[model samples]
Target chain A: MKVALVQDTPRLGDVATNLEKTVELLEEAAHRGADLALLPELFLTGYRLGDLVPEVALRLDRPGPEIERLAAVSRRIPFAVGLVEESSHHLYYNVAAWFEGGELRHVHRKCYLPTYGMFREGMDFARGDRIRTFPTPFGRAGLLICEDAWHPSAATLLALEGATLVFVLSASPLRGLGVGRHNLSIDTWVQLLTTLARFHGFPVCYVNRTGFEDGLGFGGGSFATDAAGNLLASARDIDPELLLVDVPVDRTRDMRFAYPLLRDERPELVHRELGRILGRTEETP
Target chain B: MSAPVPLPMDAPELTRQLEAFLHEEITKAGFSRAVVGVSGGLDSAVVLLLAARALGPENVLALRMPHRDSSPESLAHADLVIEKAGCPAETLEVTAPVEAAREVLGIEDPLRRGNLAARVRMIFLYDRAMARRALVVGTSNKTELLLGYSTRWGDGAYDLDPVGDLYKCQVRQLGEHLGVPREVLGKPPSADLWPGQTDEAELGFTYDDADRLLWLVVDRRVPPAEAIEQLGLERDLGRTILERMRRTQFKRALPLVCKVQARTIGIDFRYPRDWGL
Candidate 1:
């Protein structure tokens, strides 16, 4: 139930340095007795490689040596690191490699690609289609990327799929006074995720990166909250730091029972709403 | 217009075209009158001139909001231009509101009091606009806008900006072309929020330096370090310009809205206002 969130900088287009830092942070987390550790988005190549993506992208199965080493290292505790994964037809993906029990448990690709000013993820990589939960020794776990965390569908679907805990990996840019004013966004993110958790009777772990990359800074205020939306742990702003929190399933169940958001079943209407986004072709009664 | 040097195209012709364009946009937005703060600085002078040409001098109202410590010459310059442009002018000294707000909020710092001055000016401008059913004409130039120099919800608040695109130097040229007073065009540009508080003194970079660098970085889309090298400017100055651009992003965005439902606005459903045909 103990988790560690790493707030470290990724050197631009330097995969070797990124992996080295990831291993060092994972070791540090394990030393602190953390059962699970999370890293940032695109940690292998950093976030500044706009055109270097093709050169740095590694095939999913072609990450053979790196995956093997990380899996072996995960024998002590479960770890997740962000990287570029090459899929079928040579398409690239921003993927999270979840390692546990000396093996690769799941490779989750980022679903949402922010296409606003200075971001063109949709043009560079393919979108993730699958939305499902993976069984972990701790609970039914789910994964999401940076922009994915902003979408209600990503987390809501995961909750509907019976995930007791959700892990969100992000690499957001900082914008001085304007950006700091939205510090409550971290709290808002946790609130919505916890609302889903309480509605489905679960907990959520939201992780984010810290420091600047190519003049774009990260606030690094990563946090975890229970089903009742209480802050279990929080990190500092604009710095490299990690926080470990012990989240219990019994706590979620007890709070959910008291809140009874789950007991007030309205699945019929909610499913109809989901049908709208899924489209008429994919809808079922 | 022809007297201003280096004019291949007559400044009056360019001013006419820009004014016509402004009129069209204002009509499209369903507005007839404009309210602007006249500081006697180059930026506001150019804006007031443009507003007079766009919406007529009679329809353009100039508010001279000066603090207690503001230069008397600023008011003189503003009055001269107001007379020359044939526009109606009003004066609202900011001492009363500033003192009252400082006492109520227990604000002791001079900087906080200056911000209150900016907010008071905005409040008066908006009040005039509301009473006349006009739009508050903004006078911030490209340099200040790019550097994020204006206070948010204070001087930064405006309904329509007539001169936000021109740099400070360009504004001075345009002001001269539009027949703004010589003293007004020659004087240093400041917000006049506080006594003897010059813009360049606080910004640590001259308007000319900031404008040239910003023009290269934004209009030319050149990299920051390379732009600094190409312009032969100081490294720290260039870095400050880039950092300001990055930091002021929120002022350029729509309000943030949490998407509790699919196809919600802001967080999702981010299509153009004119997206679906």
Candidate 2:
């Protein structure tokens, strides 16, 4: 399947303009013969919108006219985009929505909201409690937001639930000069995604935004990896780009059969180890 | 005796990137002007020149603040930068307010007096920033920030910092590239809180040495023991710099909050700085 990752900048707190630009990019991706396109985290409203989140948060369950327009365009090709979601209960969430065939296919609320050192998502949005895969035309796919992919269990759950492809969306900032002329953060992400792909034998599509917001600069190095952890393509750093790559859909099954790590999986052992580490059996005072 | 530290990246390229970053940050923050405190040292000199180029000389405000015991050469060097950068400049002596506070508090130590002077200068700069509707540009380089050498809420308080990420040695390289006056660039770096205090004398190590170690230990992610061994640095020096970084970590972060509620301010209820502003 041909997938396109749009690494674009969002003007902070300008939802209408951001949506307009998103639609334009989605059309461009479709024109380039992409079957699916993924955008960066919070692409609809932009990241770093601090207190402006409430004002621009979208109601995705009952999406407004702007989202309906996106759905209309989805009839030509499927796409996933991130936004701040205001639920019916008025709780806010960082969400990625998948639309195909003029309908919302699935929604994944970001499960892990980073709250430490330069991130405050735990305070700003509600955490999702579930990880599941849904069927798409190409294959069964799962979605994980930026911080969610950092946790091993997030992808583990999706893989166990029979996902062949995982999409990771992020708006990570550039930090730390890397070891010997490398960007430390991007290198770290590459290590993480490659490991996830190699271990699970599932293709991972990672998309990150680029551009400056306030004092933070998001480094764009969006990429895709095959089930064998071979890098298929990567976008540019520190610039808006659309990365297109042809992912081999059959590799997931081939690698899974060849490696059989998932087949040898020991969930019960993992559960016991986690119980010991978390002290789940200990009595509370 | 030790191998020389590798020189920083191309100075002109670094200077251009920093200038573009500063320009984009200022204009994107909805401000067309900047206010910088010129200390007649490499760090501040670099910032002043960058701000002048980024925001244009007409939009940059250079404030030269000195305390009573401040070296005369410091002022002269600051004047040289102002003349070269062609930015609007003013001189403000912080003797009165600093002395007034010292008298009220009954403090006699040079450290306390220096901190007071730094805070007083911040007050003057901030007030001037408000009057001119410009942001107070910061001059604290990464070395001072990591070492916590800056006075908290004093010289540390700023609307934005252009050189905070650059190490002290890199600042000098950029200053040279920007054509900062040789008089200012060559001076022994000092806070000038007392008559004869120098940064290297107080810190007990040269910036060149410190920056090299920091690049290895912090940027290169070499283990402290490996860094000390590979760089042939004194074990005490590496330990001391790491210790200083650990001690000053609080200065780098917001005050800790006891998280009793699900969404505590600065903890769980955090948003980006530009969230709604």
Top DockQ model: 2
Question: How do the residues A1-285 of candidate 2 rate in per-residue lDDT, one tens digit apiece?
Answer: 999999998878888888899999999999999999999999988887667778889887687998898899899889899998899999999999999999888899999999987787887789988898988888999999999999999999899889999999999987643232134567788889999999999999999997677777787889999999988888876668998999998999899999998998888999999889898666789
Looking at chain B only, the TM-scores across the models are 0.89, 0.96
Worst 10 residues of 1 chain A by lDDT: A175-184
Runs off by more than 4 Å, candidate 2: A11-14, A31-33, A48-56, A178-183, A211-214, A246-285, B1-21, B49-133, B142-154, B165-186, B200-271
Candidate 1 structure quality by residue, lDDT tens digits, B1-277:
0112121223453464457545645654568888889877778788888888888899999999887778898889889888887889889888898789889999988778778888988999999989988888888877888888887778889876656766788777778888888988777778776778789988888887787777778866888888788778778877987897789988766678877886776664533221110
Name every residue pair that clashes in candidate 2: A49-B275, A50-B275, A123-B268
Chain B TM-score, model 1, reads 0.89
State the displacement of the C-alpha of residue A199, model 1, in Å, after optimal TM-score superposition.
4.0
- Cα lDDT of candidate 2 equals 0.86
So what's the TM-score on candidate 2?
0.75
Writing each residue's lDDT as its tens digit, candidate 2 over B119-177 gives: 99999999999998889999999989988899999999998887888888878877888
Give the local distance difference test score of model 1: 0.75
- Give the TM-score of each candidate: 0.52, 0.75
